[model samples]
Target: MPIDDFDLAIAPLKDLGGQRVWSLMISLFGDLARQEGQIIGGPVLSAIMSAMDVRPEAARVALHRLRKDKWIASEKHGRISHHSLTPEGRAQSQAASGRIYATPDDLPEHWLMVVTDDAETGPLEKAGFTTLMPRLYVGDASLPVPKDAATLPGQAVPDWMKRQLEPASLAESYAQLSDALHHVARDLAGADTLTPLQIATLRCLIVHNWRRLALKHPALPRPLIRDDWAGLVAHQRVAALLAAYPRPDLPEIATA
Candidate 1:
């Protein structure tokens, strides 16, 4: 309950908007507790969520929602509560891990186009295609293109198209996250060890923020991605910081 450098380190991410409590908890669980037999005690959850500026009432509401939605299961042990993802939830989290944690170098290198009517765009878009124009969608070439597939000649994206894809707001958000992470690295410098709560809180905030931005668009090819894209830098910072603060097993956190 006492404050330390982590108090300063977590301030920037605290006031950021668009953070849904349930989704943020999902991000936390996905990062550290998605494995079988993993469970987080109420005290650990409170510590991590408090550090992230989540209120107790809101946290309880999120737990209720997760339970009702069958995304998580909670247990009562004497006067304390413990939580873990349901089998369904763990499977969903596992499915997204590769995309969420992939290195920038491992991003897709080729892309293709699919021409579909408005009615058919829903399924393709859900599959990670970007709507470049009406009836035209662009996505990773590795995916099986539909019947109306079109080859991307030279795999080049024009200046106008690049502008359409990478908006100023998106760049700014990534830049902000990248800056915040730099500050965290600065604050935690010379730290030889950190409590499990500290590590979980940092990982949750970083991953939650990054996932919101990274999953906003498909993993487009290098040619399609802008040279000055802030996401590129932010992605590197996320990977590096996550490595530096390796996630602890659930037992360490449950008893912290």
Candidate 2:
């Protein structure tokens, strides 16, 4: 009955690739094992995954894929397997961490804009600059400018730029995730205590989904965003739920 209710509460998450075992595992490492030489045992990984209804075989396959892709590396010590992020993997995870963990308060009010020649737009876009106009891009104040461009402080944002901030699909996706979190929080209230494994599973689901949506949208101020932006609501809800269900200790989850 508990699992059923849990499943229903988080049903909306499934549509957002919540069951992607490999991706979820990558997210798990990014959240808990990105530190230098941090390794998670195979059993510990399985224990937490079981909470999310992932099968052992699926986890193994995902690990295999991750290793093949250089996202993770594993060593077997006397039949006990330990896994850690590869250097490349850690780099990717660290790059994403800032966006994933940033609170609304972390965003700066002012931004930096770079206007470059049309031929140079490729490099700017690849470097995470959001397109504001042809050959015009905007990013956080700290964004570095290439030698050819002149950096200017962000001033008034035109309506056209605001409309371009978030595409319809991305806005809708964040709204759906926000709404799902709301449902889960309300449903789980006063429920029986969840095992450590169960809590870890739910936490992973919440973080993985939230991170994708949060990271996709650039960190910009409220005035730069549409008034009806769902990202703001999503971030608030995610923070609240994470506070309510804190991360369990690695040992507790692994043993459970």
**All candidates' TM-scores?**
0.87, 0.85
Q: How many pairs collide in each candidate, listed in order?
A: 0, 0
Model 1 backbone overlap count: 0
The candidate maximizing lDDT is 1
Kindly state the number of residue pairs that clash in model 2: 0
lDDT agreement with native, every candidate: 0.81, 0.78
Look at candidate 1 and tell me the lDDT of residue 175: 88
Model 1 gets an lDDT of: 0.81
Which regions of candidate 1 deviate over 4 angstroms? 115-120, 153-160, 167-169
Candidate 2, run of 10 with poorest lDDT: 10-19
Model 1 worst lDDT window (10 residues): 147-156
